[model samples]
Target chain A: MHSALRFIALDWGSTRLRAYCCELTPQQELVLLAQASGPGVVKIVGTFSDVLQQVIAPFVKQYGELPIFMAGQISSSIGWFETPYLNCPVTPQAILHSVCERISGQQSLYIMSGLRYQNPSGDNDTMRGEELQLLGLLRRYPQYLHGQHLVCLPGTHCKWVLLDNGYVSWFKSAITGELFDVLLQHSILLPKPATLYTDDWATFTAGCQRALTFPNESIVHALFSVRTKQLFDAYTASNARSYLSGLLIGADVGSILHDTKVESLPTGSIILIGSGALQQAYATALTQANQQSVLITEQEVVLAGFAAVANQTLLPLSCQA
Target chain B: MHSALRFIALDWGSTRLRAYCCELTPQQELVLLAQASGPGVVKIVGTFSDVLQQVIAPFVKQYGELPIFMAGQISSSIGWFETPYLNCPVTPQAILHSVCERISGQQSLYIMSGLRYQNPSGDNDTMRGEELQLLGLLRRYPQYLHGQHLVCLPGTHCKWVLLDNGYVSWFKSAITGELFDVLLQHSILLPKPATLYTDDWATFTAGCQRALTFPNESIVHALFSVRTKQLFDAYTASNARSYLSGLLIGADVGSILHDTKVESLPTGSIILIGSGALQQAYATALTQANQQSVLITEQEVVLAGFAAVANQTLLPLSCQA
Candidate 1:
């Protein structure tokens, strides 16, 4: 195997595509060399291949014939190719083994399969990209393999995955981020904050407290309160954003705790795999709920998962299953 | 007093203004003579007088000095002239007593004051136009004067008002319509339904059922499932809109039933003051929850309320208080 640069790690999402030039070390470590991002699946309304070619042109010029390993929305129905979602409870191997491959000239592109989780209630939920991140986290840290651990991957469709002894036991998705985005752009109730205004964390925490303190009125009525608070001068335009964020995150966490099938899941601190402001908001919200969380950088886990797929480390688990 | 026509009854809200030329009968009952509507307070960024003059031009020509009784957002800060909000638990008399008036030519325009409700939890909520509608309904139906009745004015901002002995005891607002509107226009998850397609009431009832059945995952997560159902072919693009509407309305009703202070409040059938399809949707949702409801036209209540204000019939209650 060529050791210097073996694979291209790509996290193609609905609205954006992120790529990283990666190498495999002698000690079986994935090293990220160069990174690039551009228009996501949503932007490429025409041909996915053409957009992919344009987006990864720089990486291809630097390292030729390096097979691309991809995950996320790129593998779903709307992406470059449609791959079947593997049903849970699935191990890392089940994910790696289900990769669908396509060839562009001499380059080999492998897309990781998505996951379909059926909760105890028999309702099914799907995730495309975050599954790979979970696999990568498991490969890097095997401590989570013994006991049942829960991970909250917060985003546009935040995923709450329950990992039990190296298997994805069950998962649920919260549409908080997407709802928040639409509300921010469209709702007449919430005023548009100034460009220079930073998030008011105190207001956010207060919102989180409200969510925890008042569970019944948390989702529906509390959202309206964002507007009422602004109208009543209790919250300024700048602080409304943070307050909205806190309310959403707090409600999601509260739902996961109260509503889900596995309410009594023996997980201590939730493993939150996300980055930037959104993740921090969730972490703060969890803290307000008296719940502890450990944050993991999204990119690191995604790249590692792609590396794990490339090296076929997950094959043995699938074979065992 | 002139018996033929006394005043123009204006129900000015955030997005639209509905006006009715009303007359006081020999028995002191209100009779709506003619009606007109135009862009609401939100659309009138210019001088409200210009828009008002344009809309009621025909009425103005006929009834030269007939007074105009206005209620709703017209009396808000952003409306023609701001009126102070009356404190709850308040009778229709208090609302009438707080009317702010302005003289346009020989015409006296009276704008009804809003209502402010502060709960035991110390959270404050306000209502403008719905308060007038409630007062109008109370004037028309005196049965509510002796018992605790619940009135739901379903609209962009759905007002769930609790009326106890002719006073607005406690009320809550849900931004369901506004959320649904934004999601329809802005969110990528839901595909636009066919314009010519009629509403699938069965699918809507199914959505309501889902909301009632899945109480835990109903509000936040169920919204996202509208997208997944379409993606997985569980629901088509045509039915997605109805399903989304059901989910929103169902969750809203569920939230009201579960979370509010009047969770234990006993009432046979809710008094739903609304019109058209939105009212039908709420009624269907309420029926799904095994709750009965009585429908009342919003216009009748508003006009009656305005006439009551103009004739000073509500003064007796204020004097008694």
Candidate 2:
């Protein structure tokens, strides 16, 4: 039996650290061998190195001294080590070339730097973790390589990336998920229900439709409708949760597609990278907005991106490498 | 010496109660004799009647069994006594006719029912205390009765009412202030500054200008720019608060003005009923939106409204007939 090619990959974000032990298969796919997760960057009580060492202890014990790679906010300013943001119009190769390397005792570690875009008016926006997901998407399906495409990775900060000729041409970030969370917890509208509403597509679609139909700058007014709808008995408190989600997601999608810089892009076949419920919601919203979208699991994209960067570390060293 | 005409008027709302003791002069002007304030309906630990009695004890002693008038959320379902909503398109006379009365021993109390608007599509929105403010505006300045005037009362629930043909033809509420509060307290953006920035009109107006220029539903997108702006050092933590405020307020004004129904209304000289810092902020936003506005103090409006409603109670009534 051919010994499995092994490596350790971490998807470390603001609030959680997910460690993955993976093996490269003969079919050129990265397969997860074992996985563990601990507190994210914010929750770590001790130095990041200490917590990281503890998290990967099992993986290292099982497979001695495997090369490890970290992505996302772990490489951000608040992370274990600060990796500078790479200016956008970056290709997958450029992203790979920007990885920062460090030695922690016996461990070899690589971290992917985030992407920053300076707008025409000189405003800067940065994205660190999502770049790995984008790189993974491009590598997994090279078909998206040749043309301009919209890639939306929905999370706390939903990223709307324009992939022009296989490079991150420009992107915008929407605080959709974070806003939703804050509103649900702190705002008067949509108080947490006695029991979570599992699936309420009717109100969700209605919310999505409202966002799509309303004039683009009227979101503040539209949001108040969530409360009025509940007060009028049009929606129960339970279902209002889904409605709130839909309104936020729908607004994000609507604004992203309607943005002037993005209006020129091809309308159909946007790639949506999200997981579970968020994925379903965005897909439903995209459909309601009359846009075609290709759904890709966030897990697969993250892993593929992590594996690509890990595999790069194994390449033969050159004098100018 | 002639004894001053005496009555008790309370502007009782969700969080606080402002009670005013006023006398009607021989000149037919209502003058402020004395005033006091205490816990509003939501904060009252004991029965509202008990609280009211305590609040007006000195007034009752000075003038025996004075008629009391209350307006705002204190008359709503959650307040001392539940008063049903009076439908809009209501005149000052209609508002006076809708006051619900109660008697505690020798003390007689009158509470104004809030205004409720049911859209053609059957959504119900109710406004309590603001009706008094709107009424105060009309009674205070009868000239506004002649034509369509946009009366914007900026506060926790900002009310944008159309005073058409001497009546409240229609109105809409935007959760601008409440949203701003929740966002400041709960969201990652705009953490409360250790020291207030005091004034940041440059960034504030930039935010307002952004709202005016962007499409109406793009507010969700513009809001995120608050964070990105800070991330890039474009704004300090202190100034960002104003920017966030501008974004919300500007979006509100933009959407209210841009709505198809009110788009036909004359745009100049909006009646902006607010007080203090909020009034200044809304005025700034309105100017950026290319509209002229006249500022009216909320204190005068609420007090005048209470006095107006109280005047109605005295007419056609005699000690024994």
Model 2, span B8-76: residue lDDT tens: 899887667988888865455888877889897656898987898899887778777777888877877
Weakest lDDT window of 10 consecutive positions for candidate 2 chain B: B312-321
TM-score for predicted model 1 compared with the true structure: 0.90
Task: Give per-model TM-scores.
Answer: 0.90, 0.89
Interface RMSD (Å) of model 2?
Answer: 2.1
True contacts kept of each: 0.53, 0.61
lDDT tens digits by residue: candidate 2, A1-321 = 233468888999866788999987646678898999998765689888898889999988898778788898788655788888888889899887778888877667888899999888776778879999988998888988888899989877788899998999999888888788778876656644445666688888877888887744376667767777786666877678788888888889888777888778766698999889889999999888888889999989899898787666654332125
Using TM-score, give the best candidate's number: 1
Q: How many backbone clashes are present in model 1?
A: 1
Give the alpha carbon lDDT tens digit for every residue of B91-143 in model 1: 87787677777787666677788888887866678888888788788888888
Q: After superposition, how far is residue A130 of candidate 2 from its true place, in Å?
A: 0.7
